[model samples]
Every structure is written in structure tokens, then in C-alpha cells.
Target: MTSTHKNGLSPASVETIAGLSAGLISTIIVHPLDIIKTRLQVDTSSHPLLNSSRAVLRDILRNEGPTRFAALYRGLTPNLLGNSAGWALYFLWYREAQDVIRNLRGYNLGTQLTSVDYLAASSASGILSAVLTNPIWVVKTRMLSTSATQTGAYPGMIFGLRAIYKTEGIRGFFHGLTPTLFGVSHGALYFVAYERLKEWRKVSKKDQTLTNLDTIVASSLSKTFAGTLTYPHQLVRARLQTYDPGATKRVKGPGLVPLIQQIWRNEGVIGFYKGLFPNLLRVVPSTCVTFLVYENTRWALPRMFGNADDDPSNRTTVARKGERAL
Candidate 1:
């Protein structure tokens, strides 16, 4: 669609489309790390051997043989569906929330939205995305841990959900709701840092927009900081998502602290961050790609399609009130 609704595309739809494209591309390129990150977090192997991205890569090469590379993408279908929907909904909610907040406060594109604004918007977006996509992720996690020889795990999204429904009932899809809800704090921290970094760059450069490299640095740093702080919750979430037959017998309460305590007692404190390295490896680059693609698409689409929004001098006419410029 060209600018100004000429080709019938709304700004919200454009943002969604851009997010879908970016998420798919990033997932395709970096998913092996994602797989490794999940496996490491969920793996009960002694001492967490799959610590490094290289180690995971080495394992795939050593153990999988000819299908080694393909093996790395074992859960690509669930991943693509889950991630695509998450990004699309994230941007949708994020943009709408920013618009509402901007209207309430008279925030201007003439000046930037504050980091607080970003954090609030991102927190809402993260929760919405997580709730809607949790089932897909439960299936995805099972797929990731599924062995090539194991016929127990379902083959696709529909089958996986059906199996979970049959075996664990309606509550099965929300296996990790507690830790996942806790993980929304990660988004709050991430967007605050990222938005502030962008603001600082613009002020330092004496410019209205950031260069691509500046965007990358901000996105990477923000991801690393938030990812590291919240990684333990992620480990908890991954473990929670899987079916634990012993959980009912062993764990005392059906609450967050008990889960943490269970993990602590059995696997120790290190269990909560088993895959931090590989997760960081995936987080930094993938986050950079997401913002890079988003920023560029938001800027390029308008200019290419002649939407006055991207005209360097005209901030007011941008499709979304607080849409990132350049």
C-alpha cells in the first residue's frame, strides 16, 4: 500500500506487516540459538553442558549427522506462527497505547516520548502478546525438546494443542502463566533503556533521527540488560511449560515461589540461568534486527509511498502519533 490510504493500508496494518516480516526473518536466521536457549533452560542434564552458542552448534554437528542443520530448526513451524503473531500484536498494542497516552498528555512528535512512556507501552504489549501466544509457545517448547526418534510429541501446532487439551485439559495451554507474567518486567526494563538510548543519541548527534548503527547499539544494549536480568524467569517459564509428572507429587504449593524453590532445591540457583550465554547471543542480534527492520520500514514506507510523515521536516503528519522516525 502506498501512503495516505491511497492503496488502502492503515498505519496500524503497516506496523503489523512490518513486524511480521521482521520477526519471520530474524527467527529464520537465528532460531538455532533460540532452540539452544530453550533447551539449555529446560534441560536437566548435569551442570548445564549446552552453555554456549558454539557448544550447541557443536552438539548439532556432532550428534545430528546429515540432518544436523535441519534438526536445529525442528520447531520452525510453531516458532514462526507464535513469533509472527506475537510481533504483530505487540506493535499493534504498542502503537495504540502510545497514541492513547500521547493524546492524554498532549505528547508531541515535535519532541520525543519519554522512556516512561515507552516502558508503559512495552509492558502492555508484552503481556498481550504473551497471553495470546502462550499456547503456541507451550507447543513450541515441547517441539524443541522433542527428540528425532521420539514419537510422543505432536507434529504440528494443531496437533500439539489438541494433545495438550486432551491430556492436561484447558489449563494445559497456560502451563507457565506465572513465570510468563513475571517476565513482563523484562519488557518494562527493555523499552525504557532502548527509548532513552534513542533520545540520548538524538540529543548528542544534534539531529532528529538515529543512524542505523546507533539503533543497533541501543537495541542490543537494551536487550542484553533486560535479558540478563529476567533470564531466570525465562528458565522458570520454560520448565513450567513442559509437562512435569513429578510436580504434583513433589511441589508443595501451586505458586511462583514454590516453583523457584523446587528448582533451587533440585537444580540449585544455577538452574534458573542455565542458558544465559546462548540466550544473550540470540537476544542481542535478534532484537537489533527487530528494531532495525521496524525503524527502517516505518521510515522507508512513507517516503517511498509519498506520505509526508517521513519528510524530515514534518513530524506531525506521521501515521502514528509517536511512531519512531528514521
Candidate 2:
């Protein structure tokens, strides 16, 4: 397809819809794994790292009985809310940044997008989204990581949201914002790497169709690499989010630095990566599915939603032969 007619969707809308769909679908698919990952990360015990996946399953079966799927999806509500909001914002910001960069660089619509441009767009979007949605994520993490005893209902997403608001007030929602922002750096890195890898794969194969498999591979590799590199921050974020403010006085909330020091003193460096293996496994597949779904949805939405030029939401004044703005 030529640049003007390519995909027939407005770039902006395509990105937004793709991100929303992908975030929602991927969250639902992988939420159980996510809950497990969170629990493993926040355990804070002196015991050596547990077999995260197995432990998660065991805990679910033991506590919730055989029908433990409900336990697995403990925080589905907060996850859906956080993920959908995060991805939608990320895509919108990323596309806007790309447009600004393209216009400033005087790049034509048909010109092949450079690796630098993609990285810049992805990083900007990821960081912005991370900052905006950190609070929601904090609440979600807290809800997911806590035991049923703490939550009183094995809490769905709504329960978590209500509990936070009722117990801790609105500020409680943002408990882990600092660590979450730090963790967002990982996301920025992941997106940049994913885009570059995808470009390399396409160039090597001389195929630019960006197939489903391609998206999956790119997303998995990118998330794995980035997730591993930045895992400590994520662990810290989860810990801080789930830390009980009302716990006994012996448990001091000394904030981020002290917590890090305490964890280091108590558990050592390996402690930071308590759930790394399961996280790697979960994140790779989850992210891969997410990006694959996102790209495909972007490709399909124009056909389903009508032409980009006619849609005011698209904001494209001129259409080239095979190019769509996104």
C-alpha cells in the first residue's frame, strides 16, 4: 500500500484504538500471572527465592481451594483500569510526539521512519504514560499483592479501588509513584528497543508488512530485555505500594532509600530479583501478545471505522497514495 492509502486509518486514531484494545486484552489474558508475580515480589521473607510460578499455584489452591482461578485474577479490576488508561495515553502521546518530530525534521509522509524517530516517540510516550498512571498501578499492585486476609474478599479490581479510597484516602492511591516513575524508565527502554528490533527484522527480511509473529517476537524480546534490566525498580515499586501503612510500629515506613537499604541488608542483591524468572516468563508472552494485538488492530481499524481523511478525529489534511498518518 502507498503511504496515503496505507491501512486507510488516521494515524492518531489508529494508535489510540490499537493501544486501548491491546492493553485491555493483554491485561485480561495475563492478569493471573501478574498477580503471581506481584505476590512473589512482595513476599519480603528471609527465605530463599521460591519457585514463583509453582508457589503462586500452590497458594491459590491452598487458600481459595481448587477453583482458584478467582484468586489468580485477584486484581483484575484495577489491572484493566490501569492498563487501558496507561496504553491509551501512551499511544496518544507517542503518536503526537512522532508528528512533532516529523514536522520539525521536515520528513515527508512517504519517507521511511527512522529508528531514532521511533525510539524518541516510544520513549516519550512510555515515560508520560507511566507518570500519569502510576497511582492507578500502585493501587492495582497493592490489591493484587495482598493476601485475602488483608483484602477481606480476595478483592476484585473494584474492591481494591474502594478499599484504598475508603481506608487511605486519595493520597494512598499514589503511594508508589516514585518507584513507578523509575520503573517507567524500563518501559521507555523497552519500547525503543522493540521498535529498533522490529525495524531491523523488517530490513533484514525485506518485509514491511509487520506480521503478527513479528509483533509478538518484537514485544516479547523487548519486554524481557527491558524487564530484566529494570526489574529492581519494579520490585521496589511493588513493595512500596503494598507496604502496610497501618502495620505495627516496628515496621517503620522510612520511605524508598531506607526500604532499599533494608532489603539489601536483609536479602542481598538477589533479593531484588526475587521474582525475575516468573516475571520474565510472564512479561515476554504478555507483552508479545499485547503488541501483536495492537499492531493488528491498528491495521484493521481503518477498514472497520471508515477512511482517515473523512474522520475529523484523524486530523489529516492531505492524503498521499498509500500513506495513513499513523
Report lDDT per candidate: 0.74, 0.71
Measured with C-alpha atoms, the lDDT of residue 298 in candidate 2 is 64
Superposed by TM-score, candidate 1 places the C-alpha of residue 197 at a distance from the truth, in angstroms, of 0.3
lDDT of model 1 at position 243: 55
Query: Which residue pairs collide, candidate 1?
Result: none
Worst 10 residues of 1 by lDDT: 310-319
Could you tally the backbone clashes for each prediction?
0, 13
Off by over 4 Å in 1: 1-4, 45-59, 62-66, 244-255, 310-326
lDDT of 1 at 153: 55
Q: What TM-score goes with each of the models?
A: 0.86, 0.83
Give the number of colliding residue pairs in candidate 2. Answer: 13
